[model samples]
Target: MGTDNRKNLRLEVFGILKEAVSILCKNINFLIFTIIVSFPLLSFMVYYETFLFKTMVETWDLLSPRDYSNYNRPLPYQLITENMNRDFAYKLIQLGLLYLVPLHLLELFTMLLTIDLASKIYSSEDRPLTFKEMIEKPIYKAKLSSTFITSVYVLFLSTCTLLGLIWLVINYSIMLRNFIYNVLFTVIYGAAFVALLMKYLEWSAQWNVSVVISILEKVKGVEALVLSAYLCRGSEKRGRLLMLVFFAWGVCLRLPCLVLGCYEGGFGMVLQNVFNSLGNVIKWIACMVYFYDCKTRILEKKVDEEVGNVESS
Candidate 1:
């Protein structure tokens, strides 16, 4: 790759921030529409998740005393285990299949509206696909999503390989405090993996952003990825640093119950509320960054290295 313009990314950061503020000012109506329409889906998800019992144990009504008088004897552990597993597997299959119908529509329609908003709002100042433009350019968006998914899957596999090696060590023979070491390794490595995942996501955001432009205008993919990577040499650290900062912030959100426990009620009670809302709340921030990342990545300069090589030869 050509020498990366590290200094240039500072300007990019400022530009994105400015675009964010301006877009926020202009798009309140669209934002409201997004939230209002998405609310029903969100509400239904909550109902399905909480009421329907993700597991049969949570929702099932077993036969009463009169009906089960002959079944009073304690069941065999293996039989009980098999029954529990069967119930869990059944729920898992149903839950997975049930959402595909709604998820497909959201992915196909509602998601497109949001992407369109992103593309329109962020298209200025060399931004590639705005929230709006993505809807406008589905092929490019698909390519971008495909690239991201492939990268994450590869990372996951690599992590699994390393974890497999550790599993062998802990299970194969008598190793000193092997269980303790394994747990410690998981804690340390899991934190590091989360950090890396954040940085990797930011880096990939910089890749293939130009495809939004290309798909809309009919241009090059590799060129977009490379040029964006090159342009992002400096900004990587800033965004990567933000990821770590956010991770720490995330830690604070996670530990609120512990902090709350000291002031008032039992930890268990506090924890129940915290855990219930934590995932969805964190996802809210993620949804916003989804747009921000796409904006910066699309600004990459277009260049076809493959064509250049061919001509040179």
Candidate 2:
């Protein structure tokens, strides 16, 4: 019984993976358009971050004397004392938050295209979407699904961070308390994060579903989620294992870019670059895959249930 269940799960997840990948491979033009739309906005985000840091440094130098021998306090102390760099950093942070507004819209648009492809992949009949028609009228059943997806992740991360802070503050009095507390908190919270990641696997899958169903007008978001979860129910362990597989794949891809980023600067630059790359590339994919399979599997399950009901009822 267990073996049968496991086999079914593997088959369903395989369906989801093929659905997602085939869409990208099949609809090259739609994928290109998504990237093209995102490039300018993404480039601006990079430049805006770059300039903010540069400006902050320039402001610091201008305020301070070229030669600080005459000053009573040391440079680091003086910067803190005079309130030198804090405001610049704060402003840059605010700009980053605001910039996401445009990026969010761009992501939403791409998601619409991706979801359409997923729906078709699972369309028992394999109803593939064409480039010309898809561009003109994209699917949106998964539009709000994708939005809710973004919301859940942000909320999960925020909740975890708040919990960590509480643990730190409440236990600060004991000797070595913060250290021990942090270690324990990290483990527990890390597990929660993993579960959250697991739930997110549907993000990519969900959107793909939307795109697929746009033409057929088959399933909505709620049905899609439940169905996907069911299809992937037996494969949870294998699904998680696939995550580890992707994790290694992603690390290998970014390692070279990270090394180059390091030499592109110096020692401090090296560490910072590597850290940034890890955050953006590695973590980004993990979050993406979590949503990818979760949604696909749920939708696959939904498809079966719907089909069963139609034939039975």
- Clash count, candidate 2: 25
Q: Summarize candidate 1's per-residue lDDT along 52-77 as a digit string, tens digits.
A: 33243332222112233444332223
User: If scored against the real structure, what TM-score would every candidate get?
Assistant: 0.43, 0.45
lDDT of 2 by residue, 182-240 (tens): 56554554566555555444333333333223223444444544544454455556555
Q: Could you tell me the lDDT of residue 26 within candidate 1?
A: 56
What lDDT does each candidate get? 0.42, 0.45
- Identify the candidate with maximal TM-score: 2
lDDT of 2 at 25: 55
Off by over 4 Å in 2: 1-19, 27-92, 95-100, 121-128, 138-232, 245-250, 262-313
* Least accurate 10 contiguous residues by lDDT in model 2: 169-178
